[model samples]
Target: MRHTRRRLTWRGTAFLVGAFAAACTLVNVVPHGTILERPFVVEGPVGETLDLSYAELTVTEVRTADTLESSFEQAVAGGTFLVVDATWRATDGYIVFAGAEVIDAEGRSFWATSRGGCAKGTNSQPGYAWRATYCFDVPRDALAGATLRLARGTHGEDDAGQRRDAVAVVDLGIGQHDVNELWDATEKISIEMPGFASAPATDAGGEG
Candidate 1:
């Protein structure tokens, strides 16, 4: 009887220790969330007349839900948006004679109308680029497949500003997870300058 009791006690202690170890391992390996606090570059083509150059973009406040409307609401309440703080370097094939605009998927629009020079101490060139922030409002009746777009335009004393558009869409179902999951999805989105030609390669690489 005494031997049996001792064996049971030892087995119980070992089982508890194994369970604790498993739980600790699981916590360490779990995917919690992502933070894009540093600036990153996203480059692609926009149209024939311009080579879109956009970098130093940051995103924050990601929320998820079963429906687009719900997720958008949460994102808005949490101040979710995209911020672009870089320059648009004109390529040899294109000339940036005007400013740019940001158009959303739902036809909402924002403008970036300034031609400034890049500071000497930064990883930017002495060219022209627009700086702005685009706030995506939670649609009142957004469907599950709702999406948002960011467009750049050339508008000044030049030809009627040509608009080059690029889009980034999010699935509402993916946003329904916890905040961490929503953030992960947002970070995975790729923002490119559609239709524009690629800029002359620059060796301006640094930690963001």
Candidate 2:
């Protein structure tokens, strides 16, 4: 009986030591408070000449009585549909340019590119907005679909003789209404913009 008790005590002590070691390891692996990362997604439009003055880019899921009819109406009205507009500023002494594309549930896709309008600037001041138009013509057949995704692409040459690529995703919905009314609805949507000065070093570290 005494031997059995000693054995049990040894096992218990070993288990406690292992647990304490594991806890220490976990604490070391865990990140501390306050992460300094740039926020993804900005709102507003890319004005004429690539000068973007976006309110904030956001994604919202909308359910409409008639998806086809509403999507059609919004496309016709122009600027009525919710769009994910992407913009960028140079960090780490690089100049970066960004663009976006829209993909439907059925695999249909459309993309927009910057074509000589806005110029790149420092992170503190994201100069003129570089604008590109990504318009999708929702087919009359797609009605009861799942969702739409907006994918962003960033391209530019950095100071270190390297090319960089960045991508982001957002989900949106097609509301049942005319495009004109949809544009007005955009006023209700809001988004959070990352502080230019507080962006990630990798995000702002490379030259473009």
Best by TM-score: 2
| Candidate 1 Cα lDDT to native | 0.30
**Model 1, span 84-136: residue lDDT tens:** 32333333333322333334435444343111211111222233332222233
Lowest lDDT block of 10, candidate 1: 113-122
Query: Over the stretch 70-92, how does candidate 2's per-residue lDDT look in tens digits?
Result: 21131121223333333343322
Candidate 2 weakest ten by summed lDDT:
113-122
User: Each candidate's lDDT (Cα)?
Assistant: 0.30, 0.32
Q: On a 0 to 100 scale, what is the lDDT of residue 134 in model 2?
A: 31
Q: List where candidate 2 sits over 4 angstroms from the true fold.
A: 1-92, 113-164, 175-208
For the record, the alpha-carbon RMSD of candidate 1 to the native fold, in angstroms, is 20.1
Candidate 2 lDDT at 119 equals: 15
